[model samples]
Target: MGNGHGLVTLLLGAILMGASSFVQGNSSKHVVCYQGTWSVYRPGLGKFGVEDIDPFLCTHLIYAFLGIEETGQLRVIDAYLDLEDNSGRGNIKSFNALKLKNPVLKTLVAVGGWNEGSKKFSVVARDPLKRAKFVDDVVRFLQRHGFDGLDLDWEYPNQRHSLENEDRSNYITFLKELKEGLEPFSFMLSAAVGSAQFSAELSYDIPAIVPYLDLINVMAYDLHGPWDEVVGINAPLYAAAGDASDSTGRMQQLNVDAIVKYWLLAGAPPEKLVVGVPFYGRTFTLTTPDGNQPGSPHIGKGIAGKYSREPGVLGYNELCELMQQEEWTQKWESAQQVPYAFRQRQWVGYEDTRSLSLKAQYVMDHHLGGIMIWSLESDDFRGTCGQQRYPLLHEINRVLFGANTPTGLTQESSDDKPSEGFRCPAGAPEGYVRDPDDCTKFYYCSGGNTHSFNCPVGLNFDLSTKSCDYSSSVKC
Candidate 1:
């Protein structure tokens, strides 16, 4: 009787565990992070390779920039870098190998980017035979490389440098064909789409394209850049008061809220819309430092980033370093729910944990599918900036998957006191604790208790500093 009772208890426990897992899986938000293949060649930026990714952090990891050949065949941008056996270091094998860590993590190949150009896509998508061949080729390529699916990033369907007018309708047809082809294999189909009103209207028939797609990853960033005549936020959550102007055309509807609303209003299902969050910032050289607000005069691009090596752009890692400079001042725009930095003649618009937190909340409140990050390599994966490794991704996970926090880690409260009956074992390493009242002020963990410290206003804690300091002063 005792043995029978024990067996019954074990069976009940196992059933409960399985049910808990099911509930967790159903509630978790889909985090799709793009991994740029070209980032492997950027030397100064920690030379990020596929091996650097933390597969457990994201639900889907999309390998970016698989070019479309003129003949409508899918081709890797660099065969040598992607496929060559670098003693188990090759991009393709290394990326797929991430499944060893998290078997459920999905990997997809992203075809086309800003530089890949849309000519090939437009040419092939316009012809039925070519489109069929392209669809088959994409499936074969993904299967051959062990990819879970494909992400089409054609920039725009019917815009400058691409086929005009018919391209938009043809795009829907192409997606339908691609979905039909991949249906047998149960593969996922997603697309990276433009968020600007003009581009969205010209590029996609939202209602028609919806049935064929698993998710619509909106490119919410780049709404404003150096190309614009006036400065603007990189990815504003909301539009500011009196910010409306038909003169700038689509620029007026550049915020995330407007983009999401447009798609929803245009018949996109809430669960299929994945809002994008940029892991980088747009930079501008201020024409006059006195008036640093958006639309301030700017003559040229801001100082080029050392690692990104791009004028008017800076990755989160670079931005974190730049914030260390005493001259740089970080300011938040309540209306936009985004932050910007300025120093001397330079100004930058970018997202941080606070802004990203709000965005995540917005996603949850609106019943959206999930969040998509432009490029994972731009993130401070190495924990050099101090908050935590993959801080942006971590915050998203906390907000979206708080019920199942990874590794059994629980979020610490702002109360500055350890939880009841909690005690750290002896010999734990000292670390920085976040202050709830102020993000710039952090507490140091020593002797199992936290001691509070404040960083100068506009400056944040640097892990290297062991104290609050200017962004430029930290050697991240």
Candidate 2:
């Protein structure tokens, strides 16, 4: 799925005019978490869980939510919850379980997800003692399971299913207690927050939780995909003007840039923000609303695997299974750097090697924390894992960490440039202010040397190019 990207022009302008101020992050040496998802607990897999690693992609592995504590008993709750039939233990495990050793990989347990545990959390967050007990239980569970941390995925705090909602202030109090409760165990605390709209309504309360969390994983996807009357992007790199307009209604959606900026402006630390990217794509059926032709009934929804005609959402495993059985054509949208496929009258939108590459670039360009993959199991294992292709993980590690990971995609050299050259158009005015976070090379005549612009102290400037190197310690 894709969303509107109004900010592309501005991002492009920023690349062109602010080339000099472009900062190169030391992500190569930094510890970026690649939160892998284990949808449901599958027993025998042990730590390998749902996703059998083709190769290590992240520094951390995040297990999905452990359901609510109800009736004095706590149990895993989720629809399509995958559990090991014979073995009682959930599949989530340590890095060793996945057979990864190079960079340290810590497993974090997620609690209270989406519709499944919302009502239960509402009850716990209201009472301090109940909340404290929940935290204790969480710690005990982690210790028993050998997990390193906890991620809270409460869909929303105060907001309700309808316009009438509960008190929003209680969230801050709940987070404070949760933080205090987890302090003794010295565990990392994280929260999965909704996008801008829900975040605002629910009062993300980032200020109160900052001291308690190592980072916040932003659920930046779901901006668009099959839910709307017409086609739209699942996620956009930049906000576009025509998005949500008649001409672009078929393409309206959300962008990563705006979401990140919004979070930062809302007080989220950029370094402490792990951007979420979906490994799967969304799908929609198309029929000319103006014309009489009837579109497929499943117009705005997920297509199964890469087959456009197929119906419904296919998790990573489902998609992988489909890939093994079919041959599908691929197309890449330059504006979004995302891939999609079309067959007959059906359309499927998903990520490809090229789109993923751009996504990595976006994370680095913005000096944002690391990238987060929804689920590692969805990748083309044979294509991305074996000695030959090393598909998704290979490209991710190579681009983000500069690790010598092997991949089939062309590794961007230190000298790659955008096809249109970095210069602004001839007739463009000179005073345009450019963003310093563009990955492409660019030019600007806005003012005094763009390269020489003053940077916040503690940031290092390389004399060779006058660009800032923000890999290690740099004041924002």
Candidate 3:
């Protein structure tokens, strides 16, 4: 997902951009929180709350994204019977524990992440009946879990891996049907999007899909991965030019902020977009200048970490334990406000309380909806990291939502300031245009004259038509 060779270049680019805190304009004010499920599948991990970690960590989260498997034998496809019941009946105890603690927490089951969800989604979305069955099954699953909504993390639509074409039209049809079927429950629908520029461009017709969804979870992390060579960049705010920051001394690539802006400009409403934060760090073994230099080059395997690995990625759980054991020292990068560490010839990049605190600030400053973590169980409940307190959820609430409690998360009163400096265009309504000079950037001509312009971007704009084309893109 990212490159080691591009790390240095992106890092330098970020530095040049200056580490200023983001400030939100009037349009970006929605926030949704998320938590993934893989850690729950492991043995002996359920009593996360009772085990020392803050049982109430998820209490203030506006929405928690749970993962589910689409199991099958005969594909009976009842709108209610399609979801695998593991996180449902089997995991009720844990979920109920969370719900009882925080009544306002909205839990949405996310179906199909990176590797495990494509097959079933492809099958169900292609056929009307199967799609119906899936929608019905999803509804049933929600009712069974007492869930507040559903998030379609279909990894991709009309494409395999990273390539997609005409089949994309079929993808929207599937969403339209799902949206129609789930309307009765007022179910919240959202989709997890890729952070890579190419992936975002061709993956989904977001503007077309906006009508069918409540939010779009922009998976803003994983810009870099183990597969890349030369001390790779995990994530960057700007794409690197050449070989500026790595083992090859070549420019690193991928600009996360650009991805965010792309979606914003493409019609995805800022309020409906949730930014993703990884609960783990991609790991790589690097050759050192002298075994003491943390910025060494790779020598071995590039893998994900759990607890501890000299040459692999480290999941949040392991990272928390390390913080507690004092096994590694945490360092913060002013550039991205993310944290990284070096221990036993290994370099680990991850998020921490301070770093997360800063990110929360960024979210509020930029008016982003809220933060979304990969999985819920990765935080350290046992205080394994000492007094610094990796109160991930708490930090989010404190900084972005301005809430001391669950109710406060969504109930804050806005200042309602009138943007008096800007004026509406000659023919536009008072609030429709922010500034006379910026009208063309935000609005365009349509049916006749007065009411024809659009409100810019959302989850439903058509790329090819330069308008809202849900089915496909048309260059004309």
- Model 2 gets an lDDT of 0.52
Where model 2 places Cα greater than 4 Å from the true spot, the runs are 1-51, 70-73, 77-90, 93-103, 115-117, 160-167, 197-203, 244-253, 288-302, 306-311, 314-329, 384-390, 404-476
| Local distance difference test values of all predictions, in order | 0.75, 0.52, 0.50
Q: By lDDT, is 2 or 3 better?
A: 2
lDDT, candidate 1, at 79: 78
Compose the digit string of candidate 2's lDDT tens values, residues 426-459: 4554423223454222233322222112223334
Backbone clashes in candidate 3 total: 50
Model 3 residue 350 lDDT score: 69
Q: In candidate 1, residue 82 scores what lDDT?
A: 87
Candidate 2 positional error at 209, Å: 2.8
Query: What TM-score goes with each of the models?
Result: 0.79, 0.66, 0.66
lDDT (Cα, tens digit) per residue for candidate 1, span 426-460:
56454544444344555534446543334433445
Model 1 reaches what TM-score against the true structure?
0.79
Model 1 residue runs over 4 Å out of place are: 1-28, 85-89, 245-249, 403-476
Model 3 TM-score, 2 decimals = 0.66
Count of residue pairs whose backbone atoms collide, per candidate? 6, 25, 50
**Candidate achieving higher TM-score, 1 or 3:** 1
